[model samples]
Target: MIQAFVEGGWAMWPLLVFGMVTIGAAGRFAHRPQLAQLRFIGAMSLLTFVTTFHATWLAISAVLSYLSKLEDVASDQLVKILFTGLMESTRAGGLGGLLLIVTLLLVAIGTLRLTPKQG
Candidate 1:
């Protein structure tokens, strides 16, 4: 959400840039017939996974906070609750992201193996 991005501060800027670069790299590699393209694509995919994981964590934290009835709670208490939720979401998102990256790398490797070698 927009709110989450805004609240994510300066850290979000790099994530945005990473996402854009990843898209560009993917697009470029998709059209190229070189086997070496997979290395760049794989690296970009890893970066993309990192950004995606963080964004997911922030979104999850925002949604959890919004759903919880913390409106009347003290500021300190609210911060604590949000922090706890963020920590939990970070762990979950990190593992999910790692799994995704691994799967992507495996698929890329499989594709590379299937493609006929060029002289």
Candidate 2:
């Protein structure tokens, strides 16, 4: 779990940075509360899903492996061999999602935080 978080965070950092810069650019071009708020909400939801899904996938494999180990089926052997493959895919997807969310969240907050004073 900790490992998942760490790797996810690391892999996500770059993309998040990119998003911050990118969204900042978008805001410069089409700054609007509606759009910024929407971007922020979308990002938070996406990151939440990415982290949750990665954790769930890991949990599933653990349960499946345990069951297979008990039954002495090929699932155990296959599971061990396929560990890297699954982890790689999950990490890639989860990190990308996480980064996008983080980026969007930053943008949303910035929009609200830096709003101009109303006349």
Candidate 3:
């Protein structure tokens, strides 16, 4: 159902597989029908989704940089393109700072989201 709406792309297969596997595993240890159990499953799935989003954002960022910078090069050589992307992003913000900011922001949002409900 989600794949249908999200345009699936290449990431759908991997995320679907992971979601199914984890949901199944969690069911093994807990009663999935319970609300708390469902919430946990949701949190886990959201985490996985966030990880995929970060990875994909990085990949697309790299690809765009490579394509825009490379000249007179064949597109078939994606491996070379990938390396070029890594080098460029690394040079842009030195990898650590950008990833740190992204990760910290994600953590902050998650913290706010998971805060206890007010009375």
Candidate 4:
């Protein structure tokens, strides 16, 4: 995994940093709920999703590479399996990341909406 990231070049570094910051911000938000921190958490969650784009692409590529070599595999079967695996992986990571971002945004918005304006 480290080797893969190293080979992934400049893009991976920001991804790693974003992932770490997201994890840290999430942890802090869990420990303390404050409207001021919500924006940071939401931003970090979005950044994490962006950072993970490569993983999703790689998953699709892997599915394609594996299915391409299998002469016996039917087209429909291949498409079905590919989409199934892609959805599973995406839920585990891609969609899950988006869900986190949405959840954070909603929470932040709700909090702001409920808070009384200060004069």
Clashes of each: 0, 0, 0, 0
**Per-residue lDDT for 31 in model 1?**
44
Q: Against the unseen true structure, what C-alpha lDDT does each candidate score?
A: 0.58, 0.52, 0.48, 0.60
What candidate 2 gets wrong by more than 4 Å, as runs, is 1-75, 114-119
TM-score of decoy 1: 0.47
Q: 1-119 in candidate 4: lDDT tens per residue? A: 44444434444455566766766666555555566766787787776776577655665676677777888878899889878656543432533354466456555555555444421
Q: Give lDDT: candidate 3, residue 72.
A: 75
The residue-level lDDT of candidate 3 at 3 comes to 27
TM-score against truth, every candidate:
0.47, 0.36, 0.37, 0.47
Q: List the residue pairs that clash in candidate 4.
A: none
RMSD values, in order shown: 7.3, 8.2, 11.4, 7.1
* Residue 28 alpha-carbon offset, candidate 4, angstroms: 3.8
> Could you give candidate 2's per-residue lDDT for residues 1-119 as a string of tens digits?
45664544344444445545555544542344444455545554455555556554664565456555565447667667456435643654555565455555655655665646521
| Residue 38 miss distance in model 1 (angstroms) | 1.0
Kindly list the per-residue Cα lDDT of model 1 for residues 16-94, writing each as its tens digit.
Answer: 6665565555555444445676677678677777666666666675758574855688888878877765654454344
Clashing pairs in 1: none
Please state the error at residue 3 of candidate 3 in Å.
Answer: 20
Candidate 1 vs 3: which has more lDDT: 1
**Weakest 10 consecutive residues of candidate 2 by summed lDDT:** 7-16
